[model samples]
Target chain A: MASADNVGILGWGAYIPIYRISSDEIARVWGFDDKIPDSIWVEEKAVGAIDEDTVTMSWEASRYALMRSGIDPSEIGAVFVGTESKPYSVKPTATIVAEALGIPPKKLASDLEFACRAASEAIRISIGLVKSQIAKATLVIGADTAQGAPGDLLEFSASSGAAAYIIGNPNQAAAVIVASNSYITDTPDFWRRDGAPYPEHGEIFTGEPAYFHHIVNAVNGLFEEYGFTPKDFDYAVFHQPNGKFPLQVGAKLGFDREKILPGIVTPYVGNTYNGSALLGLAKVLDIAKEDEWILVAPFGSGAGADAYAIRVTDKIEEKRSLAPTVEELIKRKILISYGEYTKMRGKIRKYER
Target chain B: MFKDSVPKYWRLRDVVYRLKYIYCRDCGKSSFPPRSKCPYCGSSNIDHRYSKGNGVVEEYTVMYQSEARYQDYQPIVFGVIRLDEGFRIVAPIVDVDPNSVEEGMRVEATLRRVRVDGSTGLIQYGIKFRPSRR
Candidate 1:
């Protein structure tokens, strides 16, 4: 029965796999011509090895968040992991992560499933929990290991990564959660059938029906609901299944390309499903100035969106010195060949016996 | 064949090299591997101090032999020493015959190789204590 406005993001962390799969290599293997863009817009996509999954990635991201926030794990009242791919069909991945982090058992904990928008929803839920005084702090994690049907355009961009945020009251916060809005629809633009190995998406349909429509409506709805305009935001990050979508949507919303450029993590990391948009937002927060406004919109496959407006605080500038930024992470050298990508993504087996 | 668990360089140059450990000024508790604040007091007030690297032998053990890769050195002598600073550290002891090992003997820290990290290709140094010559 608590309001979400009372809760704010206290700390944020991100993780992109060390290995990179060049779009050029993808094009070469797929037999696409040299004229095709290396990444439809960016140059490469990050690929996690076979050993990593949503759970492992969330653990790493949360480690960074806990370290940066200096928040004791025992103080957290809730643990929420939002992902499309659960490590197990029935067991809650959140419980596993909570146990690994040594968080106390007497806490509110659950896994959220809403396609890519689940993480944003988790954030909203944490805000409400803090507002109602039911919980003093919550750790919201978004992660995914998105698999695309072989030879599809999605294969080139669907990769794995994760992001996490510690949300709590403003007095104990690092950034203020200014406002948020949700744009929902029952459009099934993309989906994976039961037991299907990969997701099936309506290519051109996904563009207008889900990505464009939902993002535009969400941004506009947040503006209408909060009485703010595009110019008021310093950065706008959308669920980037591919690099071009966020830029295309930003242009439609009257935002300058530069404003959204810093939040575009897909060019280097690919679509991390639930973590895509939030990863971009985390990067922006790394270099954002105090009081700077940031807008985030995450669109899911079945068709739903969550948009949030946040303002950076002095704590952000203070915490900036403690952790590595997206730029620093980007400078690490990790190269994977086309064959390795196939192996890492489980497209091919090494021991076909 | 058993693979060499440690690298040749680390085995040859055994120094327990770590970022210096710091102790809390308010609470004389020592921190291993070093930290900016004391975990006990949560105070950033701390100072770096070197371990005397000498201690009383708390326990001792002997390995009749090791895996094939390390077979050249048979009957290894390993021991744990309780340092004057109130911490227990484990290391291999050399110079004294393995059959002559005994507990409560005074020992001093000595440099020796620990292991090899395949990725970085560098020798890791560790502290091994030997009976004090004095």
Candidate 2:
């Protein structure tokens, strides 16, 4: 449903780690051919430091969101972190983020898991909260340090990053949330068992049956309900499992390649999983002009997808520079070796008493 | 024997999370790791404040040795930062080359994993500094 009230994005921010490992490095170590990275359309992927995790990245991104919005931490009514890579299995990552941001004792705080679409769901939930007046504003974060087996194709794409947004009154928003909806199913194209460190996928089954099916259905659901066509939007961002999937999906949905190109980030930073589509939206927000329309479709392989129609406002020009832009964060990189990547990712066993 | 205590970390959450300080209104100075009594003027009249997180490195050193738990993150650069507001606190510098850090370099605060008790214990998170872009 379209928000009855004026619920919009107050601010947006992203955090990408500086460390990087090329697809070539991963390929060489695993005895894969050189064209493997090219086949996936990923050159390099961002890596979190040994000391960093989902919680720390979420805090950094949220801090910037607060800075851009100029909102006091106590005023936030809800906090949500969507990730598959939470540091602790039982402890909540959201409380740690809320506390680090000084968001006070009274707030709706919890972690949500839907593979990758959890943060997208957080945004949809925040829109409802603001529309109903249950909260004046809310913080929604998408972050991940996704895992892949040593010799698996996922190793080239499972990376780390975070994107955060503040949802509040439309009058204070940089971009208004026109409408949003989600589509989900019992499709199990990708999964990791409860205690498994690395996830397994259904290979090509992840493409058409999982990612494409859920995302197309979600976007079509919005189009059918809202009467919006592909031509109506100035830009479209899809969950980027690789550099090629977004373009392929966009083409399938009748959107031009040009409209989807600006939002594709997986080629450079790898698939930040939760951060993939959100980070693309953040980049578009940084460069989009007043009144421009953006189509956001984020898919998670459990599987599900959330589609949002966003309209930019004049406030974007002023608020865009309040925090570091996604492009700038992506450029601040230090390439590491395959061995270093293994170390940072904790692939090595450690001794303990 | 105890590796660490939850109460110790919980009690100092504010300071640990945000780098909080107590500004002695009477003395016009800020004391970090905030306390009820001001160290400079011995006054109880103080207000809790958070550092703007902008600072400059006053001095720094790289530690190649540490307790076993911290071995994964060795060659850690420890620096004494003087916040833009003019109070000094020591913290680890991350996201940059350890050998490249120098005196008077600009820095900014960021939350990070300070330590973890073990596989089953709490993961303590606190404020750390990194090279500032602006």
DockQ of each: 0.03, 0.67
lDDT of 1 by residue, A1-353 (tens): 11236457777888776678877788888887755554367577777654456766786687668867778888899999999887666778787677656578989888898888888889888878888888888999999988876678787888888999999878656778877788889988888876677888887899898889998898898888777888889998888988888999999999999999999888887889999998998899888988888888988877888888887787887776665576666655378888777766667633211
Clashes of each: 9, 0
- Residues A199-222, candidate 2: write the lDDT tens digits: 989999999999999999999998
Question: Per-prediction interface RMSD?
Answer: 16.7, 1.8
**Best of the candidates, lDDT:** 2
TM-score of chain B of 2: 0.95
TM-score of model 2 (CA atoms): 0.98
Worst 10 residues of 1 chain A by lDDT: A344-353
**Candidate 1 CAPRI category:** incorrect
